[model samples]
Target: MMISVLVSPAPPEGIAPTFGWGTFAAWDSDLYRNIVINGYSYDFSRNEYLVAFFPLLPLLIKAVMFLGLPFEIAGFLINNLAFLGAVLLVYNWVKELYSIKAARWATAVLVWCPYSLFGTVIYTEGLFLLFSTAALRAFQKKQHFWAAIWGALATATRLPGLAIMFTFLIVSWREKRSLIAYIASLCSGGGLFLYSLYCGMKFGEPLAFLKAQKAWQPAQDFWGQDWLKMFMQVLVGSRNWKAGKIVDPLHIIIVLLICLGAYLLWRSHLKLGQNKTQFGYCILAIILWLLAGSPLINTVTILGGVYLIWHFRAQLNLLATYGFCSFGIIFSSGRATSAERYTYAIISVSIALGLLLEQYPRWGYPVLILFGFLLASLAVRFSQQLWAG
Candidate 1:
């Protein structure tokens, strides 16, 4: 549907954009394709943006290219394959926590989300989902070794992979698990740890990846004032006569929905379920929010994850923790460039909606239909190069 919508408006006369091996290589896919072909270069004068991307997906693309396929073809195939694996893992994980119906619904939500088209491109969302879901499920099933393996791969895939470690450690400590289990879970960061060492040797800074992100000049206020102020500015932009592009109705709707979602999740339980662990995460999220100095969109995604955690704390503690940790890690950096894609990667909103649909089939179907409509609209906007995010 999206491709068809965008395909009609052919390039204007003489304006020829290189459509790399089908349109799947749109936008950020070009970066991954270049990474696959040229490999990483430390020369800041040329390709420093490469450092913002993790190495695992490009490495996987290179391995796939060994089969003599075109780079774009290999990249698309890799993403689609990983997406299939991710959907299946999500289904199984939700099934373990809930029911088959809920699992099916959750898988639908995961696979067809508005921002999920990235999973079909040469992006890390698909591969990251495969690794993150596998690690989360393995940990839930008491398969610590497998969890560590997947978590390590996930960490190598995206920075947010560190969320798995936080989830693992917190859950382990809460359950009074073995020290060995906690240590094993900590191994999830092994890939990132090794990469940092390699970076230090090559680029003379173990934190070179962190330094590379400076190209984006992500907004930051360690005191939290800038973060909250930006959020409020966006929230009540209508009141500001000269707010300009910052006053987006979509953002306001998103903020209201996030607040409403958190309230709903809180009321999902009869008694307030606030505890030290939840409070600690709340503080962590606030601190991260303040330090991140990210835009309003990214903050909303984090709040969405917090709402998911608050809502499902009783039904499934593991899912809530996973959601919170994932949101925290993503928001920690403070860039809102691809906040929607990042939120979909964590996927707690989809999971929650899926279960809600299963629980209330009557209204749930209607809501799902409405959501589908919204998703289609967003897809169309994205296909047309509009600001769907």
Candidate 2:
């Protein structure tokens, strides 16, 4: 993060950096800060609605600010610390279930993935990952009390945390676990239930959070035009997709060539070795991403995640169920915005990838190298107040 800040070009005229932290507090960061300082408010006239944001991070920042820290410092401290805790939890949990090598690779993937930029910034990704991972790990260990506590905190942090709660309930039913398991599963949603109560009292609408989401993302029918545009953009490049014509023939050509190369690589039985082939694919993927950008990423993360979960379902068990549940919710949202970041936060994807990488350590190295490059680029983009993830 420091390197990203240091390498960032100066802000353009009429633009200001966020306290020399390069604009880590841009976009949703500002909204979170507003929620912290001014508290929640709703004003359609001004197009302001704080209820769209969950209260956990802002509430934590407010608590930290009571000690005289500014919003930026408090937010940075909280998010980074929470991210570190999440890394530790993921590492230990993976090590317990798999191998130490897999655990190390998993933590590395979590840190180096480009979307991880959100974890270090003033977003719920870090806090949500920490709480959700804790809850999932505790449940795996049969620590019902801690699972419920962490699960409640997770749900309060982000809506996807509900997937963790549902995973518990489904796994308990399938396994015929004790009544305490069912109780804990239900209690896991306590945070969301409390938030709903607050919304009912404050706005006279218990589902105001869901309503406010429409402000950011207008409702659309299932598999609507927006979804089609996103998927097409991934294949043909954004310009060509939006223009409804081949604005850049080279883009589609490159995409097709990359796809062909991937298929050939999969079919080859050459003696080139797995390391070289994996590295080659990594380079091709980087080129593909460069052509298609975030739409491609969003497509790959969601679709690829589903494939990973299904392929590893038996080994992953509860984690696989959580991945499916998370995807189900994301699909219902009917928008592609932040899909990569949201999918990455699910933890199951990371663990699944880590387990896959564990068997092919050579392949893991190039993947991690690619991830590091993208991670640095994303950090610089975020620091420059540009859209990332």
Candidate 3:
């Protein structure tokens, strides 16, 4: 946070740069601040709608504002504190289920990943992660009441929290848990239900939040070609994909070389040691993702999450189920914007990556270094009011 504030460059001519803590409160932060100070508003003509944002973060900020703190301070404190709590919870939870080493690596990944910038900024990522992680941990411990309570708060914080509720309900049914487990699962969605009720009473539209999303990214067809475009952007460069024709022969050559390298690596795997082979694969994947830009990063975050969860499904159990449910919601949204941030919020991805890194400790160092560079870059971009995700 300090780095973001201190290192932000001056805005371009004729543009005012946000300074100090305010720098963290750009884009979506303004909407949250407005909601906190003046409550929700919907202005169709101006495309201004607070209904599009979930209420929990603003409400929490408002609660803190009663102490006479400004919205920026309140929001900054709330999000940072919640993120701290989340990291601690992740550490302890992973340590308990896995090992001290695994816990450390996972915590490092969660804290240093580029998307961690959202946790620092005025966003629901921190609060949502804290609540959802608490709910998942509680459910794993068979503490149904705590699970439902935390899960409810989670749902209120973000839509992905529905995945937590679904995970509990489905897992309870599959495991034939007691009625209390089932009841808790149903009760987990209380936050969303309450929000819906408020929307119905205020706007005469219970699904106003979902509808308001069109204000940001107009709804696309359910099985649209957007996903294909995103995939193509990953294989080719975004510019070439957007050109609607092969604008760069270099992109094609790079893609073919990557494929060839992968095939060669697989064929020669028996000759290489396990650690070397795994490290080589990791390096290759990172290179490919970096070359592809944000679209590929977003695509890989979601699809790679699926691959991770599925590969470790037996071990992850309910966590895997939650990951799938979250991904399903992202997929169903039919838009790719912010997919990377959303995927980062799913605790399963961190846990899975942590577990994998624990085995190949050698890979964790370079990965963490890379993550640190990306994290700092994102923080700088966000502070400059540029799109970091």
Report the number of the highest-lDDT candidate.
Answer: 3
Query: What tens digits encode model 2's per-residue C-alpha lDDT throughout 1-389?
Result: 56656555665632333446435677799999889878887665777778888889999999999999888889988999999999999999999998899898889889988788888888889999999999988998899999999999999988788898889999899989899999999999988889889989988888888778778676566665677888888888888977888888998899889999988887872766776777678878888878888787778878888898898999899899889999988878778778788999989999998888888787788778878887887776677777786
For 1-389, candidate 3 gives per-residue lDDT tens digits of: 45645655575731245557787788899889889878887667878668988889988998999999998899999999999999999999999998999899999989998899999989999999999999999999999999999999999998778888889989999999999999999899989999999999998889888878867686555664677878888887787878888889787788788888888889989999777777778777877866776776677677888898898899889899999999898888677778889999999999998988898788888889878987887777777777787
List candidate 2 stretches off by more than 4 Å.
1-7, 10-22, 218-224, 263-268, 271-280
Segments of candidate 1 deviating more than 4 angstroms: 1-7, 10-20, 43-47, 218-302, 377-389
Better candidate number, 1 or 2, judged by lDDT: 2
Lowest-sum lDDT 10-residue window in model 2: 13-22
Lowest lDDT sum, 10 consecutive residues, model 1, at 10-19
Cα RMSD, each candidate: 8.4, 2.2, 2.2
* Candidate 1 global TM-score: 0.77
